[model samples]
Target: MSPATSLTRNQKLAALAFVLGVALVYYASHPLLLCRQLIIRDDEALYARLHLGNDLPYAWLTESDYSFRLAEALLQGKLGLTEPPPEWVNETIPLRGRYYSVFPLGSVLTMLPFALAHRLIAFSPSGAAIALIGALATFLFLRFALRCGRNFRDAVWLTLFSTLGTWLWTNTAMGGAWQLALGFAMTGELAA
Candidate 1:
């Protein structure tokens, strides 16, 4: 192939990669997937409340274990905490007489933008944000595949397989607190 033609082809391939990555992420992050509450005992609900300016340190005490805490925290007033609940009794970090999530803050930090957007728009945006993260993770995996001397086609296949054909898909789509944390950790390692 001519030099100019090869360059143009490469550019096209790069664009295709980006577009496909974005489209797949969008598809996976739909609210339909999020509304099902596949995993309830997750940090996403807590983070969402925190981003919306609700008191996080004490909210968990009254929130039901089976109910959608994010929706309740957003719409309802905080219930009076007469006593620490069973869930909170064991998992709290006491700081300055306030309790906090035992989970790390990384996942919450990652979802901050989405939480803010959701707060503003009155809709959950976690799915989209998680999808974007997953897409970026796929791109990083693609780069890693290329650096390992994979052909363009093979690298693309590897990226798809790694992101979609593994637990990565479940974590990204579900966007549960622990799942997202695991996804972010794995993606961070891959990107690094």
Candidate 2:
């Protein structure tokens, strides 16, 4: 009932909607976001070839930074947040190659950690594990959207817009098809 609260109530929700819309642009691209930390440590060709080759022991080690290689070799099966690189490489973010040139480079990076995962978990559950991660991300997104406003109908519409918007769909087509799906799901919630 205070003057400030009244003023806030008077403001159009359009601003909130616009912010959510712009946020949807970024959210539609979440899968690409998670991979940035890893990508910062390695080049495009090295990681792509490693992934395409199925994360072979020697190949992964050679493509990965020294610390990442050492840790992956030692603990190939653990599941948790990875440690940052102990050292830096110049021009670490490569801009060349098919995946990088086309997609935003996030999908590749997001897949990077899983390369070493083969050494740890049973191969049978890997697909399931990745799916679980995607589902969890989607859940988090829904929670965030609910917190943004009380209008359930409005939130649902926004969710659809953010999840299936052009930015995400186009980017997904460019590269990282799987990541695009997961990322759009997570971001859609936030955008809603």
Candidate 3:
């Protein structure tokens, strides 16, 4: 890689900082957190520092848990749910004795690692995973923007606009089934 094309040390640090900022903003954009609800009791100690109350798991926010089942099925080498999903899975369809998610496989595949983690150690990974995808997608955008322009600061502003000024803000923050897929699609587009 040519020196002119590659990021300098300060530019790399700035890009990483931008990614971290994106992650923090997206995670805090959750509706419950935004409202400053007393329901975010978390192990991270962040809520304590912020002086917020509430458990981390929000029911509406977890409507996308069905996505994990699809990811898990893929891990097991199946395109369809071999075992029936829980009764609460609303957006699934039963076809020819097989059940599948209404969301496409691509979206489900994006969350594959989170599903694998949940299956392996029974740790809840969806919340962390969504923020991670959001960060990764933003990081990709920063790289692309910097490549197209010579100024890293200008790239940061453009990237911020793309993220904050678009529907991505709501969709990625909501963390719903469709939203999760959209985040993956955006990341895939940025990657391309």
Candidate 4:
């Protein structure tokens, strides 16, 4: 049998907690790593808000930018864009001569505060939000693993496999609002 399988329950619990701490640190920093890789597009600059390397960190002329736009609109006490969308924006429905995002409202709400506090989040609010939700998912996963009473080695392996082996990493790597909602939903799944 492996040495880990022979540890006392308290030892196992302590080790699991330490592993969780390390996992949290990793999730917290994951976004910064992702952000550094972003190449900002000149057109995306106006709404880029926070600039890492002063670059556009999002997709242009795509539905991916909808949440950011929705957030900007919500800040103005409306759900639809006040002015015409640029030719690049998509996945929106036209209503009452205004354009609204076709994506879930959850994304718009998630981006609202960041849009509202555009000056405070250091130009990467979307990334920061993704990071926060990712960390929460990590915490939930660790808790779930611990509650299952798996051995220390098994627990660590599970967390690593889930984080690296799954598309979870891919979703969090981008700053899209859909990705954020997906990550948040995954966090909810972890809690269940």
Compare the candidates by lDDT and give the number of the best one. 3
Compose the digit string of candidate 1's lDDT tens values, residues 152-177.
67877887888778877765565555
Candidate 4 local Cα displacement, residue 104, angstroms: 2.1
* Model 3, TM vs. native: 0.73
In candidate 4, where is summed lDDT lowest over 10 consecutive residues? 54-63
Looking at model 2, the pairs that clash are 32-106, 77-120
TM-score of each: 0.57, 0.30, 0.73, 0.66
Q: What lDDT is reached at residue 26 by model 4? A: 41
Q: After superposition, how far is residue 163 of candidate 1 from its true place, in Å?
A: 0.8
By TM-score rank, best first, the candidates go 3, 4, 1, 2
Query: In candidate 4, what are the lDDT values of residues 17-101, reduced to their tens digit?
Result: 6555544444444444333434433334534546434254344322355787788888878879978886556567888889988
**Residue 11 lDDT in model 1?**
54
Clashes of 1: 1
Error of 2 at 137 (Å): 5.9
In order of lDDT, best first, we have: 3, 4, 1, 2
Between prediction 1 and prediction 2, the one with superior TM-score is 1
Candidate 2: TM-score? 0.30
Better of 1 and 2 by lDDT: 1
